[model samples]
Target: MQNLQEGERALTAAVAAAGRTRLWSHPELGLHAFVDAAGSVRLGTSDRNWAALVPLVEATATGHGRLWSGERFVETAIGDRLAYRGHETVEDGGRERTTIRLADSVTGLAADVVLETCRGAGFLRARVRLVNEGGTPLRLESVTTLTLGGIAGADDGLGGLTLHWADNDWLAECRWRRTAFRDQVVPLSRSVHGHEGRGCFERCSQGSWSTGRHLPMGALTDRDGRAWLWQIESSAGWRFETGEREGAAYVALFGPDDAHHQWHQTLAPGEEFHTVPAALVRTEAGGLDAAFGELTDYRRDIRREHPDHRTLPVIYNDYMNTLMGDPTTRKLLPLIEAAGAAGAEVFVIDAGWYDDDAQGWWDAVGAWEPARGRFPGGIQEVLDAIRGHGMTPGLWLEPEVVGVRSPLARTLPPEAFFRRGGIRVTEHGRHHLDLRHPAARAHLDSVVDRLAGEWGVGYLKLDYNINIGPGTENGPESPGSGLLGHHRAHLDWMASVLDRHPGLVLENCGSGGLRMDYAQLTVAQLQSTSDQQDLLRYPPIAAAAATAVTPEQAAVWAYPQPGHTLDEIAFTLAGALLGRVHLSGFLDRMNDDQFALVRSALRLYKDIRPEIAGARPFWPLGLPGWDDAWIAQGLRGRHSTFVTVWRRGPADGTSCELTLPHLRGARLQPSVLHPTASDSTAEWDATEAKLTVFLPRPDTAVLLRLR
Candidate 1:
């Protein structure tokens, strides 16, 4: 034991020395390895590996005799560190001998490794640069591997969780299986599933068979596919899986197979891409959510630095229904008033604010004018009405589209619009504005600036109805014509607009849920789940919202439509409570019963808004194959809790049972707040292993106060 301790000390000293040397001499190079004070060794570097490997391949081609490069060593007080950062000139028989340069603006040296204490979590972040450094186009097929330390004889409890691979259109064509070193390989070909329209692949295995587990991590392409590899592991007590992507380049605290999240990038010759993978390590205490919260908070800080940061939640109202009928400010004012009375934070006037001409929806899109016949006084009247109701006013705009018949169409040249066969084509009722053009960007900036700076609008709902063609006039070119880069540029333009209008809240909508990715979510606070507004549709919508994003980020809208009833409306409103609620129903058309229920729900939501905002929810019932009854609990602090229950269909004359987890050691008292019950309150001890509570029919909710 003494000798082992001495050996560990020596290892730690050596790692520390290596870290110090790398940090000093070549702070920006390949495969840097270092050790922190906690004795965890970290190896990482900026995408330099692609460049480093290029020289080796070239040497092999040139038939160089065992092409070798000298290593440079640096000395520190603890130990010595060695690094190699030069080109290998090689010669292979009958192959062209090539000397590959190790450095280029995009293909060269990048910060590759970080081994340090990040926010109190001992972690190792490995980054590698993937550069197209060779004359012949190259593709990357790499896998990230990690070997567990101090677990040679001990068992790593990866068995408790499951592994899920995110499904993608690209990954669907391939067939694969998960194989264990000592155990049977699990065939997961059909096991892969899709959620919220994205792909999710899953498998479960026990880590007790061996101290190490190898996961299939490389992109299965012979030539043209490249991907950055990410791997994370935590102390066994956590509930989340070891291999999963949660829509971002990270894992979730809930479970591995729960969802797949990743950021994808395609690189062209002489072009490079960069991404950050944040890791959190909990020493047998916190879960993935706790770690994610740290990253979320960091992102929030970055968002706050932007000039336009909206603090209040915004909802979609009125304009979506305009497609069915003429939506005038007078028709929308009452609904806005009711929504305000019902505790709506912001009211957005959706599409149809402008008049369409022969040129299509594009003509009126960039022009921020209300239809003269619909609103003689213009949009300011609607803004005033919303503001009068004590709610922030938001307006929808599709600056990226232009109607050919619009007044600006004659003013702007045809070259400003995206064209097909020399004619501006219409898509989804609008013509795409060439956002890739500098003049078009300037026009959009001016349009947004006028609304935010001049019109006093506090919020803007930007909509994109169709996908714009990747700015390549020719067919697919190398580096892929900067499709994502142009989209990112458009995003930057929007961010700049927000920077100019600091108070404006931007809600992104791509015909609803199409652009619901991390890039858009990072800039926009809320996203529309779907265009549908029926109350019954809220369950699947809310479930999808829960799966893809946090409840706070979802913007769920509901309207009465044709078949929805008052009771159904209230129950549907209850579903919206699980997320950020948006109202679009005709408030004036509702009877007294509907009004009263809306008032009650609004009061209840306002009462526990903070709890709803901060609490972590557990879906005890709803969707997941359970009946029409649904139960969700929001727990805040240690003693305060809020619970919502909904009984759909006829309720079957039988009460549903609800069991509360994580509520031990407290006295929980639940009460029915709606539908007038004789015995409203029930007291029980929460310390029991499980407590089953009966839920009445037609959707019932109980608030539990712990003392």
Candidate 2:
């Protein structure tokens, strides 16, 4: 034991060593790294036999390498070794942003590696830019955003390392699966190469929702308890791969893989191509949750500054149960009144507010205007009504598409919409607008300014409901490149809208979470987790959403219907407790008793909502299974932990236990934050480091705080 402790101390010292270059270390997080003069990177969590390796950040031209024989980062082909050019560092909101420049003289390629961090933060973000400085254009086949070479440097083989991959779908989001990195990705090999060889495990997102097929994030944990999580922030194509080769194992992150993406950009002289930003979190203590907890902090650090994320306002949309996009003045009055009474901060009149009541309103939606019949006294009357209740008025706008039958669809030039082969690309009877074009931007800007600026609306729920496949082929670039370009332009446009309305908040929704990516989340104040109304299935999405986004940005609906019992009402409300509560359903029709339950939950949500801004997410019962009878997701704050547990189905899961060893050694006082029911019981079993709960019936939920 003494010898083992001495070895661990030696590894700690070695991990902290500056080696050939000055090492940058996060003082409190125990993360350390250094880049040598040759552009080789050595980093890790400072645990023995568990270090990250990046011997090369290679890029191969058409004629480079052993002609692309599984070679990473153009290592053996360049005539001259990559040399460190210089470095620049800047600070943003207390975080350090460093740009380290490296160049290969023979290849005439300059790589600017950008990294972000803080003194005590447990995470760092990295990306690379490849610039062509040579006399002619070069066709680059493969370029990796980040190549974490030697991810398992000291180990003979990555036999014990585990990879955690997150998967997402339409209603099902943030599903995480943990498997042996070797067995799942790169199979453990009996046939070894020298003393340090390994196989590869790779996963990637092809287009659009990077988490559509699988999330653009993953984590690897070693036997010694060292864990590192890496996530890609792009909404477009992104990839991450883990492999063993030569004498080491590696994890490489990329924006697009040329093999599948058909992406090969020819960089002209003085031209540059930058990869998407990616972040990595490392921890040697408390396992995966600890690493992710720091990642949560890093996620918060990277988000664009906004007050709404801090406020976590409860939104009441006129969609789900009451109106369903067919809101009239009569329908809006009673629902709006109930919403205010239930403690909603923003009352958004969802879809169909603009269309004539007689016409179908699904597709012809570009020209955003209040219908004469729907709003008899104009939209302002409803706005005044909402203000009278002391709540902000918001409206839903699908700014990206124009209805095919709408006048603007024919009036706007073909160049304004996504085009292919000299024609507008129509999907689901709606034409997607190419925001990159000035005309398209002008149209949407006018709509936003009128609603938010003229009408004094404080919030805009931006919705996009169509998928134009890879993208439009009308522009000079490929469809994928065009899509990415439009994505950046759209984000800029959203920022401009925010600038126009200083107090306005934007909600991002793409057919409910199809575009729920970090790129959109950065600018948009919040994300609609799902449109699923099933109270049972929603718990999983709400529980898992924290993995994909911060709890504050995850707008989960706590819709309680008029027919639901008190137990059923609590079950519905619990899903949104730890997230941004997007209250919905037919509250106007609900009885006073049924409505009181919602108001009780809302009061509790408002009380604890502030702490959620600075909280770190955790799955006390692990990532909630889609069909799990009982599920739990929680947030740990500075002085308290808030947990929401749901018992669903007739599975007789009223009696359940939760293990929260995070407060194991501390003296904690536990109490119900929401539900406030006399029958619901949560008793702390300190000896076992668990909290056991018992409810009399199914479809019931409870919110508990342990401080």
lDDT agreement with native, every candidate: 0.43, 0.76
lDDT of 2 by residue, 256-358 (tens): 6456454566789999888778888878766677777888888787778998988888899989866888888888888889999999989999988898835
How many angstroms is residue 31 displaced in model 1 relative to the true structure, after the best TM-score fit? Answer: 17
Task: Please state every model's RMSD to the true fold in angstroms.
Answer: 13.3, 5.7
Poorly placed runs, candidate 2 (over 4 Å): 1-52, 65-81, 88-93, 153-157, 186-199, 246-248, 357-359, 650-653
Model 1 worst lDDT window (10 residues): 71-80
Question: Which candidate ranks first by lDDT, i.e. highest?
Answer: 2
lDDT of 2 at 7: 33
